[model samples]
Target: MTPRDLLRSAGRNTFRRPLRAFLTIVAIAIGAFTFTVTSGLGTGINTYIDSQTRAVGASRTVQVTGTSVMSFLNERMEVYRDDMDTARGMDVGSGILGEEDLQRITSALGPDDEYSANRQVSALYYSHDGGQRYRFVYNGYWPGKTANLVAGDQLRDDTDQAQLIVPSYATRPLGFASAQDAVGRTVEIGVLGQDGEVRTVPGTVVGVQEKSLIGGNLPFGNQVLDDALQDASWAGSAEDDAQWYSSVLVTGEDPDRISRDVAAQGYATATAEQTVGDYKSIVNGILLLLNLLAGVAIVAAMFGIVNTLMMSIQERTRQIGMFRALGMGRRRVFSSVALEAALLGVIGSVVAVALGVLAGRLLGPMALDLAGLDLPGLELFAFDATSLVAIVLGVTVAALVAALPPALRAARMDPMDALRENR
Candidate 1:
């Protein structure tokens, strides 16, 4: 038979067994719908984690901390192509990175690589002015240190003058509306220098800054927590010698590997990849459980399809015998059955896609409400081309899987036998 004729026959056969066709199609639709929704949610979660990690500057940072000597070369470098025998451990505390180490690491990195080094001293600050003391955590810096900035400029390179730049919103308490307002103003900071001296540095507000979503926050400082003391220019400097920093920031391809190598050099590295992975793992684990439950609902639906198809076969036995008696091939009969199943799959998938998109739009706002923060620029669901392809493939596979047994059973029927059964 011609392909068009086969399709026409399939359509007629489907309607002739209305209850069976309805049940099978509904099963396919349920499976397709569940798959689309779950997959979309998975992609959304991954995107959300990426955004948060990137927001905090996770990928480009490899947080370096004191490690046991044995931590060095803990595992063999089997994955690396480089010769490790000639590589020596670089000690961070020894100040080997002052200038030369920076050049070497930068040179060793591919042409695309760029890096910045900083002695990150975590400290607390509060508005010294009696106006309203706000406590905040900030990354202390030496004058002119390069921390990636999002809004304002970095501290000047040539001066010993201390300077500070904060997020755009940081200026609200400083009697300013934004980073532009805080710029050029003086801000008081409580910090400890390398000499273990506690002192407050009344630094000029140089610039505001933003970092990339794939990189992280500024290297020198971040938005202070609510409890960190907020100090204004009127507040006199206070010093504490307890805080110390042992970290450097780098960005490029294989940032995580570079961080591992930096740890080999003895300086602590902080990269965003580790942070993003941790975030993804946590979210994926939770979502995976939810998806599993959704899968159960779909599996139940597939069994319903099986029952519907079985009934369809029995009802069409006489028709099958007539076709076979007329010299129609068993394979031709099988094709008709399979095509019907596939068409149902396609219809279900199309409907599910539409429904999933609608659901995602509605659900995203609710999810954000639960998160308790407004994500102004963030989309509720982040599905890309890959996700779209996956949905189509998944639906098609489900249809074929459901069709196989039924199609085979129909094809195996004998003309006389099927006719007798119809009686």
Candidate 2:
């Protein structure tokens, strides 16, 4: 028989026992839906993390921070921890980086390399619109990468006036109705100065960003703001300047070699890849477990496909014998059975992927609301063309594999015996 004729026959046979085929398809769809959603979540998170990492640091960035008090190597460098986040940044066990310390840290680097300092700073209180002042924290690490702007513009390098980017979640708490409202507002920042007192400094809110894991509740400051805060910080004080320094950042193509060289100079280093990967690993671990559970569903669906096709073959014994008697080749018979199973899989996967994407668009925001999170631009169900196509192809291939036994049985039928069996 021709391929088109065989395909038509398979399509026609797939629904001979409509209810059975329907049930099998349902089972496959369930698994496909779960797989689509889980994979999408992982993809979305990884994409976001990668973009953020690029903005915060380069592939070859090596962070040169203060000495690690936790290190038993006689305080060589700041201890690196995967779990360390912005919330626990200041409390991390590390000695101060002195001015000489910055020089010492950079001196170990190749002359072609340059560095940026992430001096730590705090804002005791912020006030706008004459409301109650709320406390906040600011960091000096500047990616000048893509800014997650909901409103206004990213901090301009051309200007040095203290400019801050507030997170979207903090708009209401900071006396703003919306992200747009928060922009361009002059606010008071209380920075602790060298003389041991909090000084109210004026700054403009240039932009607002999405709430992020890496940054936590922290707002970002431009270079001028960072320097001003650093001037008030412990490491920035002239009296302690010679004895302490903050985190210094620089880029080198070969981080392993760069880190090794720095270690010889009595310093420790953290690459941007390592720091970002730790966070990605945490995300990946959870997604892996979720995907595994989805895999279980798919495996169960395979059994459903086998059972459905076997029953179909048994019901069609006489029909199979008649087709064999009609001079149909064994390969054609096998192809027909296989195509029926593949049709079921194609329908299931297509339906599942379509519904999954729809659910993501409709219910994604509801999930965030239910969880009491205000993370803007966070999509729980992101999908791409490649992955969607892969899901369909994978399910179809799995269906064919599962139906192999039934197809072989149908192909090997003895015309006279099968014709007489169901008589």
Candidate 3:
């Protein structure tokens, strides 16, 4: 028979036992869909992580603060089993990485090395509309990046104390709806400075950023870009408030190599890739467990296909004997059974993929509610080209595996005995 005829025969036989075919298809679809969705989530996670790493503009970053006088690290180490545990119990003290220490670290670096320091402080925003408050605000501060500079100039070292670069959120009360319009205007920055004084500083907006990153060690909330020079001024003014040096950023193509070399210079380093990888691993582990559970549904469906095929073989004993007497090879008989299984797999995969795409679209908007996070660009289910290819491969593999035993049994039937018994 021609290949087209064989295919037609396969399709016809697949539905001979409709329930069994349906079950087999369901199994294949479940397996394929799980594989596709898990892989897609992993990809999205890694992409999101890398974007965060780039936002920091550093392959490696180190945070060195003053060692506390009370020997908290030592006390924690004595009480805890490991460095990680000790870190959890410890709090930073002065002299770890002050201006003088930063200068010293910079001096120690090779001529090729360059670094920048950032000041980190937490404060609550007082957003009031005639005594009606919407929400309390938390945000981060950054230096700048070449990618996201939408308007005006980036935070420069020579900026006066009165100038600031506020995040887009800061402009809500001022009647500006967009980040672009917020730049070049003035905003209020409130904080309890060093000493027992509460201070609110007014500064000019220098720039606006397009992307809002919320991953890695970079930042946890909305962010504003500020000049490094201004950071020093804030720290100096609020000495008692103690704005810690968040990071000393270092850049190089290969962060692992750069971090190791930097460590030898008496300064610690953490590669952005390494940090991001750790975060991805945590997310991947969760997805794996969830996908595995989804896969169980597919396994149950496969049993239905097997039962259907076995019944078909029994009912067609007389037909099988006739085909054998007509000189059809055992291999052809096996091919017929296997082809049916394959067709079922193909149909199931197609249906599942279409379903997955629809699910992603419907669930994308609910990402915020499900995840308890307002991820700006998140989709609950994403149907990507790579995922589609993976689904097809998974379905094909399942079909071949499920077909092998049944095909062999059907091919090995005793033709003469089957014909006599049928009569």
- Candidate 2: stretches off by over 4 Å: 47-62, 66-90, 94-104, 118-123, 128-131, 143-146, 150-152, 157-160, 168-186, 193-196, 210-217, 235-242, 251-276, 419-423
Better of 2 and 3 by lDDT: 2
* Residue 347, candidate 2: alpha-carbon lDDT: 95
User: Which digits, one per residue and each the tens of the lDDT, describe model 1 over residues 1-423?
Assistant: 999999898888777767766766676677666666777777876776565653555354444444321234432222322332211222333222334455545554556655444434424453423345445645433222343454567555455555555654456675666657677776665644333444454656777654333323332433231112222211232343122223345556677677767666655454555656756677788777766765675566556655666678877887887888888999998888888777776766777777777788788778877976454445556666676566656666666677778888888887896568757
Model 1: what TM-score? 0.70
In the range 179-282, model 3's lDDT, one tens digit per residue, is 67766665554443333244444556666544444332121221223442233235435234333354465543445655666556555455555556656678
Candidate 1, number of clashes: 46
Write model 2 residue lDDT over 103-188, tens digit each, in one string: 77778788777677665565577778668788765545563534667788887667978888777777888788898999999888
TM-score of candidate 3 to 2 decimals:
0.72
Give per-model TM-scores: 0.70, 0.79, 0.72
What is the alpha-carbon lDDT of model 2 when measured against the actual structure? 0.74
Largest TM-score belongs to which candidate?
2
- Between prediction 2 and prediction 3, which has the larger TM-score? 2
Measured by lDDT, the strongest candidate is 2
